[model samples]
Target: MNVEPLVPVTEQDIQRYEEDGVVCLRGMFDSDWIERMRAAIERNLANAGTLAIEYAEGKSPGRFLGDMFMWTRDEDFRAFVFDSPAARIAQKIMRSQKVNFFYDHLFVKEPGTLVPTPWHQDQPYWPVQGSQICSVWLALDRVSRESSGMEYVKGSHKWGKWYKPRGFDGKDRYPEAQGETIPDIDQDRAKYGFLNGDMEPGDCLIHQAMTIHGSGGNVTNHTRRRALATRWTGDDATYDTRPGTFQKIREPGLRTGDPMDCEMFPRIAT
Candidate 1:
């Protein structure tokens, strides 16, 4: 499938992303593309036996695992990531000769679910080191501030603080050092205004790796907040696993500090 080229990211958009740590782009995908991805997600959700199943008794599959990347096993998800307009936008934002696919995550929040993602930076959770990494948060459904959509801190990416990682269900898991307070956006919601990503099907929000972001719970009935997040790093990115964390690099031909040259993380345009 040949996806059309995205409009070149303007100087203003790049500056905005750098300054605010998040930027919104509309019409990145059309209705047809949205439907294709929606169907792809449905297919993966229906076939429980296809991918690695992490089932919890007496709970829906959505509640148990929260659907990590199915692209590694599902063909439809693979096509969506490898052969879609999403990859093009990722390359444009980073302004690198090539953009490497870090990974894909599928976050599905079922209705009335109170699981909140704690305030943290994506860089801390990642196994790589670099400031070039960014995430494209494509919402497959209508997202609002009340429905626990993404909330980011404006210009927090420049803080340069190493935060602790917590469970996605909003439990603290980080060992606090002396004089270190756990990242909490809820404490001062007024000072750090919520950068609510109120997005439609074709709209997408791009954020930096160090940006402080998290979401609330899904309270509405039958509202599915499905997001396809594709992470990318610049050609100068490197792989340095954390002490206790184990990251499985799916793509081959990647060295520790080498530029991303694998096919899975392709140079879509440049």
Candidate 2:
């Protein structure tokens, strides 16, 4: 399988990511990567990892399932972390000399899933700190607002504010999380300049860790919304043992302020 992106990461894309904190790169991966990841998602659904969370099971209208760190145990996900174009893409967009694989997360929203993912910043929930941390969200199926396309608040990453993390249940994930409360974007959506659009299979959205984003429920009666988010950190990322931060299922074994380039968060590109 080709590991290189089908299309180059242009300067404009990098600029957009820097200025807006997110950029949609169309057709970055080919069908081969898509199919391989799709199969891997199925395997993960059947045998969920230890950290898997079925957020909507028995409580919501449809399913909103999530799991992280699959690359530690799944061969397909391991291959993606080591051999996919995601790392190079992160390196380019972040303009860093090196890139490390942070983790891989799976989000599956079965058709008619009515659980809306609450708006929040990603960094506040994780045990890491850096400006170059990002997630490459790859769509394995057609995506749109109706299918729960993720929407980002344009340029919100530059605001230098960390909103408290929220879970899929629309409740606070950490009661002790210290940060500014998220603005009621839903109440005043027009003022935030939410950026979202339709994406086809193999397309991806690369967004910085601080970007405030969320998605609606999978309202399509029959179209499933499955996505794989491969997170990568660049040269400046480091371990952070902050209070209220969620611990990784498999600890990275790095003390506070250490570079995130150990066995778990292996350096993939330099």
Candidate 3:
């Protein structure tokens, strides 16, 4: 279906991202990119990576899934990283002179999946550090709040707090790195303002790594919620291969405080 090709990022988009810490880019990805990623998602599912994890299993009525570093094994994902406008958009939003590829993540929730992604921040789980990191979450299917759409706490990035990282099942990502526990947004939605949008296949959400966000379970009877989040870091983001790293794909041999260079975090845009 020939979606309108992704247009150049507008000034307002950057403003929204900076102010709200999360922005929805309507039709930010072309149909070709969407199709390629959909295919790549299927391939990744068929051959799960070492970091792939399933949140729903035996006796579970639905599928709550996860995977990482797909670009290493999938050509389509590689193309999306190097050929798509993701890096360009990231560079503009981050207001950075250069952009680097961080990694990729895939999350799928089949119909009837009842597991909600716990509210959490992204940076605390990672070995990298900086405010220039961001994620472009692309939807392969139409998504709304009820369909497990990602919900963000507006301006949570400015909170200046590093919350604990927890698994989809609510376990801590690192036992010793436990900082503050994330508030239960679902329990008190009114206390903390949230932003969620209905997104089409070609649409995507760009959010800061420090932004607190997560998705609910898929309640639809037939629709599947499949999403791919390509993370990128800018000039300010640096390597910190400390212990308790989250989703450590290939260790880019850089010492702590070093710039995120090397093949693992290749400079994608300048």
Candidate 4:
């Protein structure tokens, strides 16, 4: 894996990220990183972490598997983190002078998994603040809307609201979460515009932390939908170590509103 920065980040790409709150980049990651992430995800699935979750088992014909922060436990994940284009992409999307590692996330939909991920913002669930935070999700398999392709509300990050977090298991990830409930964008699809596209291996979707986004399940009977997400924070992102959020684990010595650069969330780009 090679973490080469995207040389000459395009002005148009930056403009789209600023206006739409999300953008999709293609061919930024090569086959090496893609293969490494696939291997790592398979290994993580074999030995799932204590926090790993499986949904739609028995209730449906497929399973939705999710896990996070495997970089601490897997060599391939670590290599990808420190050796992939994620950090560079994050830096460019955020338009920041520096970027820090946040965490790694894995999502899998085997087939016929119909559960839709609830619409919500990512920043409210995390222990962080500031607009310079985002996640880059890479599709390891060919993904379409019917095959659990992630969708984002165009320019939702500029809404300046924090909605309560929702879970994929049809439960509140934060039961006692405070804030406005996300509107039924999917219900009133015409009222709110959406952005989604087919993605292949090495293609990545960069979304603002405050952007409202979610995905449906794999409707196909045989194809698999595999996606890996790497989250990052820019120069201004800081910790908000408050309790009762959707976040499960906490890093040491990071008090409320401290700069988010530590061993757990190391500075990745500058």
Candidate with best lDDT: 2
Q: Which residue pairs does candidate 3 place in steric collision?
A: none
Stretches of model 2 off by over 4 angstroms after superposition: none
lDDT ranking, best first: 2, 3, 4, 1
**Of the pair 1 and 2, which is ahead by lDDT?**
2
lDDT of 2 by residue, 1-270 (tens): 668889999999999999998999999988999999999999999999888888887767888889999999989999999888888888999999999888888999999998788888899998888899999999999999999999999999999898877666655667877788899899997688878999999999999999999998899999999999999898899989887776477777788999998998899953
Model 4 Cα RMSD, 1 decimal: 1.6
Query: All candidates' lDDT scores?
Result: 0.69, 0.89, 0.85, 0.83
Candidate 4 per-residue C-alpha lDDT over 16-122 given as tens digits, one digit per residue, 9 for 90 to 100: 98999999998788788888788878888888887777867656777898888888888888877887888888898888999999898889988789877768888
Overall local distance difference test of candidate 1: 0.69
lDDT of 3: 0.85
TM-score of candidate 3 versus the correct structure, residues matched by position: 0.95
lDDT of 3 by residue, 66-87 (tens): 9988888888888888888878
Residue-wise lDDT of candidate 1 within 169-229, one digit each (tens)?
4434333321134455687677775577578877788999888888877777777777778
- In candidate 3 the C-alpha lDDT for residue 176 amounts to 63
TM-score result, candidate 2: 0.97
Instruction: Provide the clash count, candidate 1.
Output: 0
